[model samples]
Target: MTPPRLTPVAERAVLVEFGTVVDAAVHAAVLALDRALGADPVPGQVEVVPAMVNLLVVFDPLVTDHAAVRAALASRLADLVPEAGQGAVHEVPVCYDGAFGRDLAAVAAQAGCSVEAVIAAHLAGEYHVAMYGFAPGYAYLTGVPEPIRLPRKPAPVRGVPAGSVIIAAGQCLVTTLTMPTGWWVIGRSPTPILTGDPARPFLFAVGDRVRFRRVGVDALAGTQSGALPAPGGA
Candidate 1:
């Protein structure tokens, strides 16, 4: 495994930065370290949070100092291997037409392609859940094909409906709640990304692969998008 740069988050916690850019290998390393820490923990480890290309390890300062934390991380990663660890695969249905995707036309114009082409590109690429943030169950996904990648809008939109799937910064996201955003609102997902249920709060997890499946508005009727059909599966 590639070594991570050990940075201090304070006197206690440590941020294990794996890479400067978001990459598949970096994501794998992040998750690998996360699993290892949970499976065979270091002393005073308070929490192990995974991000796009790094892991935030919060430990109890009283029990373990910075040096000890660093040493534990190094020891744990010494023989570590990047993993794909039984993560789930999700085929989320999306509504890309009409008001649900107000920015579809804009994205198509920016990409210099037809609306159909933009949707096709999104559906074609298999995305990885790099991390979740900005809100509960709100995931930041990578693997937006380079050809269609766009920057966040110069100005942010006030609020988008929950289930909106926006794209920007070479990534895609499914909104967990009604919130304002700078990313282009390309579509709306049929499934709710966040939930109050304790059993399954988020539909996806880091390392899980997802492919967006275009769906008609009728399909979303009466179906709770976040409604789990089954407990767990890829």
Candidate 2:
């Protein structure tokens, strides 16, 4: 594994960057370092925020300086072992009928395929939770198949419902709130990704794997059980 470059961020944090690109290997390295720091934190380390190609390690300024933190990070990097398949995998059930998939036909037309073919292409993809942003429970999932990949709309659409599964720029996302979006809404999942509990607010963490299962509209009823289904085989 290549050593990550450490850049001082303000006075209390260091940005450990693996690379400039959004490659899976780079993301895996970021998550590996994150796990390392979480398991064995350096002196004064307070928090670590993992991202696509980097992570921010925040330290208590009163307890440690940049030099000391950098030294500790170097030592940890020397001993860091790459972890394989590090996060939990979830199989999400999505309904592609009716209002849930208003953009399905459009996406199909753009991709030069049938709506069913588009759905099949989407379900065939095994996405990874790259990061979470935009909203509390919003997850940015990566690894969308090339055939179904499309750019986000030039303008955001208003009143998009929550639980809507959308894709754009080779990424997949499930809307956590009724908000405007520019991505194509191909389907909606019934699983409650956001639990109101403060202890575990979001359903997915960075690096988790996600697979979609196609289900009919009738199957969506009574499926919102306040938590995602247990992780199972793809």
Q: Which candidate is the best by lDDT?
A: 2
Q: Residues 1-234, candidate 2, lDDT per residue (tens digit)?
A: 366899999999999999998887888888888889998999999999888888899999999989999999998888877676778999998999877888999999999999999999999999998888777778899989999999999999987777889999789998888788899988879876886668987888787899999988777666655332222200
RMSD of candidate 1 to true structure, Å: 5.4
For residues 1-234, could you state the per-residue lDDT of candidate 1 as single tens digits? 355899998777899988888777888889888878989999999988899878899999888888999998999989787767457889988988777778888988999999999999999988888888777788888889876899999989875777778999678998877778899988777677765578987888777889999998676566665431221111
The true-structure Cα RMSD of candidate 2 reads: 5.2
Off by more than 4 A, model 2: 197-199, 222-234
- Candidate 2 TM-score versus the reference: 0.89
Candidate 1 lDDT trough over 10 residues, lowest sum: 225-234
User: How much is the lDDT of residue 78 in candidate 1?
Assistant: 90
Q: Considering summed lDDT, which 10 consecutive residues are worst modelled in model 2?
A: 225-234
